[model samples]
Each structure stands twice: as C-alpha cells, then as structure tokens.
Target: MDKLLSIVIPSYNAEKFLDNVLGELVKCHNLNRLDIMVINDGSTDQTAEIGQKYQDSYPGSVRLISKENGGYGSTINTGIAQANGRYFKVVDADDWLDSKNLDRFVGLLKRTETDLILTPFWAFNDKNHHKHIPEIKPDDISWGQKYYLKEQGICPVPSMHTYTLRTKLLQENEIQLDEHAYYVDIEYILYPIPYVKTFEFVNIPLYNYRVNQDNQSISMTNMRKNQQQHSLVVDHVNSYIKEHADGLNPNQQELMVNRLSRMIATQLKIIDLAPIQMATKHELSSFYRKVKDKYYFEPKDINLPMRWLIKSRFNLFPVIHYLAILKMQLVHY
Candidate 1:
C-alpha cells in the first residue's frame, strides 16, 4: 500500500481562492500519494459549497468538513485530529503549491522518510507576475544553516505554511495550535522546531504565497495583530533557546537576544497603537514582564544605546516599548 500523505487546509471565507488552491493540489504529479482534508471553518460565504463541490468531484481523494468558526488555530487543530496519513502538510487557503514540484517532494519523502521537510515558497504581488524568490546557499548546508536562514536576511522566509511533517511527530508531541487571535502558526511550527531531530529543506519553490494588497491576511494596516503574533513567536523561540539550545558562544547569544528584543519592541508597537480591548492591556503587560524579567541585565554589559533605552524606561519602558514599536514594522515591510 502507498504511504498516505494528508494535506490539511483550514479555510474561512476563502471561496474566491479555494478553487485555484484545490485545483493545484488535484493536478499534483502524484495524486494517489495524498489525502486532501479541508476543514471549512464556518465560512459565512460559499467556501463550504466550494469544498463540497470538490468532494463530489474527487470523492475519496478529497474530504471536506464544515465546522463552526473557531479561528485558524482551532480549525487546523481539528484537521490534525482527523488526519490518518503517514505524513501531513498544511496549505493556507490563499496559497497554492507548484504542481510541477509535487512529485519531486513526494519522491524525496518516500526515500528519506525525514521527520519534516521544508521547501521554499514564492511570494508574489499583482505587479509582479513571477514569484519573489529568496536566496540560499546551494550546497553544503547544515540543518542549522537552513533553520536560521531567515534571520540573516538570506532566506527572508516566514510562515512555513507549506511544510510536510511526519505524522509520528504530531502524535508524539501532541502538538496543537494556541487559540490566540494571532501566533497560531508559531505555536504549531516554531514550538516543534527545536525538537525536530531529522529535518530537511529543499531549494525548490513548492508554494506560491499571494500577497495582493486586498487580501485580508496581507493587510499592512493590521499591524497590531501581526506584531503581537510575531512577539509571541520570538518569546517562544527565546525560551526554546534557553532550555534546548546549548553550547552557544557569546556572539550567538547576542545575536539571538538582539533579534528577540527587537521583535518584542515591535510587538509592543502593535499593542500600544492598535485599538484593542481594555482587558488585553493586562495580558500584554504580563507578556512584557515575562520577557523583561527573563532578559534583564546590567546596562554596562552590552550596547550603550540599548542599555540606556532599557534603563530610561525602567518602570515605563514597556510603555515606551510600545511607542517605538510603531516603527518596528520597518523591519518587515
């Protein structure tokens, strides 16, 4: 029997793009190798109808579930629970994979049986017909090199929404998404990164991420939600470093902490400037304290400006942290 590959798609009001996304999956070079499961998250639109149409057309190859709206995290968690494949993958409703590269990926997985495989994605805009590709060293790449590629501005990748993970890892870790308005992927993706023993990356672009200006997921205005999610990811990563990452030199620690601090500052910008509920203030304060206490050190030990900035707001830095965060988006866009 062929090993089953489960592809989970969490959808919400995505009818406009679901057809194109599902069509790519159906036309993949190895159709028999995949079991596509799409959990329609209470889409108030025709998303459910579209999914049903695909189910009718593809029958056993495609399965669709219409569940109540529960944000992206809950939707993906539900799909993961129902998946029966030997390996699993996730695709955003807005993104599509390159059908031409499907067989190459499946063949690689069949041969290596790696725990996780990450392939590069093409981020495209309406002005640019071709996908924007990120740079990476061609050969002699280590897992660490591939992992930190984004940090050095070489890979410039985030949101690994197209990764294929072995089912055993999910079952083993009992991995589930956190139900925050943001950071769902971080909880599912980064939380597991440090623990992965056998991970691989392919240079080929297997996914297309549509970055149209009108797309809700790509809105530059929703900086608050995006930054908060980014903060949660960085905090989780920093914690992972302290506990799991060992034998790091001073330079590496500085680099990691610097990145984490910058992300925290950026997140503060989102929370401070955005219109959020009053109750969220406490939650944000708690998060800030956790990060502050963990990283607090003598001012003289590091960069002068960072030290002064950290000290000037000693009690009020979290507030200033939020203000400076407004410009934090400069790093991303």
Candidate 2:
C-alpha cells in the first residue's frame, strides 16, 4: 500500500536530537500512512545507529539511508528520488513534528491534491524553552481553501517548515537543489513556484522548528562564516527570476517578485552585519549591480535602510555596519 506522506529527516551528527524527533513521529496515530525516511548524511556520531534502531523497531514506517556526507540539499534530493508516498515534507534532524496534529494533517493529504500545502510552524528556542508562531500566512486568505495561485492577489512565500509539496510534482519537474551549499532552503522554496498553481493553507502548526542553536546555519556567526554561500544562493534566485518571471501570470509574477525582494533585503542585511572587510564591500557592490541588471520589475516596498544604501550607492555601508552591530548587541544583552 502507498503511504500518504513522506517525512524526510536529514541528519548529520544528530544523535543528541534524533531520538526526540523520531520518538515524536512514533507517537502519531497514522504511522502506517507515514513513510519516514531518515537520511543519515555520513554522521561520525551515533546518528546511523539510532536510525537503524528505529528502523528495526518500526520496519514498516522507518527506513534509514546511510550515504556519504552530502549537504542538506542532497539528502532532500535523495528523498525525492526514493519517496514512496503521495506528499513529501523535509524535517531537520534537530526538529520534530507536532505529533498531536499528524493525524489530521495526514487525513487532509489523503483527500486533497493541492500542488502545495502550507501550515503554520512553531519557532522553538531550545535555550529558554520558548516557542512562538511567525505570521507567515496572509491574513486575507481563508484557511483550508484551495486557491489557484494565478487568481490569488499576492501570497507569502512559505518557509521550508511550512511547505509540503506533492512528491510527484517534485520528481516530475526535476527540482534539484544546489548540493554542498548553505542557504539552499530558499532554492527549495523558489524552484517550485512556477509549477505551483494551487495551494491550501492549514492553520495547524505541524512543524516544530528548533532555533537558538549556535551551530545552526541561520545563526549570525555561521551565516557570516558562510556569507559566500548565501551570496551564491542569492545569485541563483536572481537568475531564476530573470528567466522565469516573465512567463508567469501577473499574480504569480507579483508573488515571485515579492519573494525575491525580501531575499535581496536579507542579503543586504547579512552584508551589513558582516565585519567591515574589503570582500564584504565588494559583495555589496556586486549584489547591487546584479539586481540592477537582472531585475526588470521594480521590487515592491523596499525597506528604508536598503533604500538609503541604494540611493547613496552603498557609501554609507560603514554607518549601516556599525548600526547593525549595535542592534545585535542590544538584542543579545
């Protein structure tokens, strides 16, 4: 029998948290309907052992794929290739799903054929045990209604946690992400947009995203260390938009542009917070030139700081960099 949902957990040296993640999944009522693929990306720790233990216990639902260390994107690509389920989701090894809502979420997937499914997710802080939901869903949209993307005025881009794409859609489109790269989560979100004509929003918070880990990629220190990878992702997104945006319907085009604009703003902020180095300044200059040359459509609602940087031709970068440092210190303090 075909499983209803494929949950791919990409793990690397995650022995500390893999137990909790898989433990939560085993609590779901519809275990038979869930195809859990735990991709152990060459963990030097006990990650593979834990995964094998679970697969031994729950042979029907849990399968472990032990492969060499490919980055996060490669695990996802492998999952897509091997998926036996109708719908697909990627859950990080450090994160777990809301098992309480799994049954309902699975039931919905069993019935609907929407190209994309969106659900609210909790941003959990492990240090303080605080959790909150970000308002990524648009307020104007009705929950649980399947709407065509071309008809919807504007839609917010779903984060990786919120997205559940059709397995067939991903495989059929050959939607491969950049291997051995940080920040390819943005690519996972963007590559499917042109094909995603229908989407449904579910209000249930299905994904519990663990945050505040120092080693996490989104952390300031790691982001600064891997700024070049982030820049590479930004370049890929810009190229994608330049090639594909024109072919989309007006509403879809607006949605793509909105997502691109936000990404540009984020890249600028990353550059601002980075140490004042010649390389950082060069990245800033290169980014502006790329945006100017590639983005034919005027991005909507450019933020104040970004506007200032652009207007001044980025000469005020030192001021912005210092201000960003002060803001970070104040937040941490």
Q: Name the candidate that leads on TM-score.
A: 2
Worst 10 residues of 2 by lDDT: 324-333
**Model 2 CA deviation exceeding 4 Å by range:** 277-283, 296-301, 326-333
TM-scores for the candidates: 0.72, 0.93
C-alpha lDDT score of every prediction, in listed order: 0.64, 0.85
RMSD for each model, in Å, please?
6.3, 2.2
* lDDT of candidate 2 over 1-333, digit per residue (tens): 779999999998999999999999999999999999999999999999999999999999999999999999999999999999999999999999999898889988879999999998998977888889888778788998999988885465768899999999999989988889998998888788888889888888899988777787866777678888887887887788777866788776777677777777767878878778777778888877877777633545457777787777788888888876666544421
lDDT of 1 by residue, 119-161 (tens): 7777766444556765433344544223432232212224555
| Runs in model 1 lying further than 4 Å from the true structure | 127-130, 136-158, 215-218, 225-265, 271-290, 295-333
